[model samples]
Each structure stands twice: as C-alpha cells, then as structure tokens.
Target: MRFLYLLRRPPYSGSLAAEAIDSILVAGVFDQRVSVLFKDDGVLQLLKDQQGQLLGHRSVNKMLAALPEYEIEELFVCARSLAERALSLDQLSLPVQVLDEVGQQTLIAAQNVVMND
Candidate 1:
C-alpha cells in the first residue's frame, strides 16, 4: 500500500513529529511504499544543526537521516513553507523535493492513505 505521512508540527512540539517518524519506519519495515511531506512548521524538522537533546528529546535530524536506510526516500517539502521561513534547500539536513500548492494537492490525491500529524 502507498502511505503518505503529512507532518505539520514542529519537532519540539511534544511528540507528534517523533510519533510520525516511528509510524513511517513501521510502514517501511512492512515494505509499504511510503512518502513523507513536511509542511508549515514541520519544515523546521529538516533544518540543520538541531539541538533536540538540549530539550531532552531525541535528535529529529538523526531520525530523519534513517529514512533512506528503510527505503523510504520519497521525502517532500512545501515550497511556500520554506519561502515563508526564508529557508533554502541548502539549509535543510536532508534533500527533499519542494512542492508548490498544486503539486501538493496532486500528491495528496495520489496517495492510497494520508496521515496528518
């Protein structure tokens, strides 16, 4: 099955981001086709030099870096979200395909399941 995980929360905003990552990893382990999209404040999860341990949390950056190992490589980000935050692709820890409004809609439409966090 194709699973799309839409993350809209910041990494430090409780455990939502970590929970989403865990779910994605589980799905990948089951050999599901998984894709992840970071939108709004969720894009912050992809920013480099995150000090998650300072806040008593596991490093989100390290967690994200493991996605490829699980064969979950369809990572995407909202173009407008990055622009609003003044972040370029170079500022992110992982390389993600930037999607505009229409692209985002198309991707969501193509998913067999969409989970938002």
Candidate 2:
C-alpha cells in the first residue's frame, strides 16, 4: 500500500513530528510504500545543522537521516512554505522535491492513504 505522511508541525514543537517519523519507519518496515511531505513549519524539520540536543531531545535530523536505510526516499517539501520562511533547498539536510500547490494536490490525490500530523 502507498502511505503518505503529511507533516505540518515544527520538529521541536512537541512530540508529533517524532511520532510521525516513528510511524513512517514502521510502515516502511512492513514493506509499505511511504512518502513524507514537509509542509508549513514542518519544513523546519529539514533545516541543516539543527541542535535539538540543546533542548534535551534527540536530533530530528539524525532520525530523519535513517529514512533512506528503510527505503523510504520519497521526501518532499512545500515550495511556498520554504519561500515564506526564506529557506533554499541548499539549506536543508536532505534533497527533497519541492512541490507547488498543484503538485501538492496531485501527489496527495495519488496516495492510497494520507496521514497528517
């Protein structure tokens, strides 16, 4: 099955981002196709050189780095979100496809299941 995880929360706002990552990993482990979309402030999760350790939390970047090992490589970010935050793709920890409004809608519509966090 194809699973799309929509992340709309910042990395350290609370535990939602981490929980979503955990869920994605689990889905990947079960051999399900998984994709992740970083939207809104959730795009912050991809910023390079974040220091979650300063907040006594495990590094979200490090956790996200493990996605490739699980074969979950379809990562995307909202173009408008990044532009609004003045972030360029070069500033992110991983290479992600930047989706505009129409692209986002098409991608979401192609998914078998969409889970938002």
lDDT of 2: 0.93
How do all models score by TM-score?
0.98, 0.98
**lDDT on C-alpha atoms for all candidate structures:** 0.94, 0.93
Candidate maximizing lDDT:
1
Query: Model 2: which ten-residue window has the lowest total lDDT?
Result: 53-62
Error of 1 at 6 (Å): 0.3
Query: Which residue pairs of candidate 2 clash?
Result: none
Q: By TM-score, how accurate is candidate 2?
A: 0.98
Taking the tens digit of each residue's C-alpha lDDT, what string does model 2 give over 1-113? 88999999999987888888999899999999999999999999998898988998878888899999999999999999999999999999998999999999999999999
Q: 32, model 1: CA deviation in Å? A: 0.7
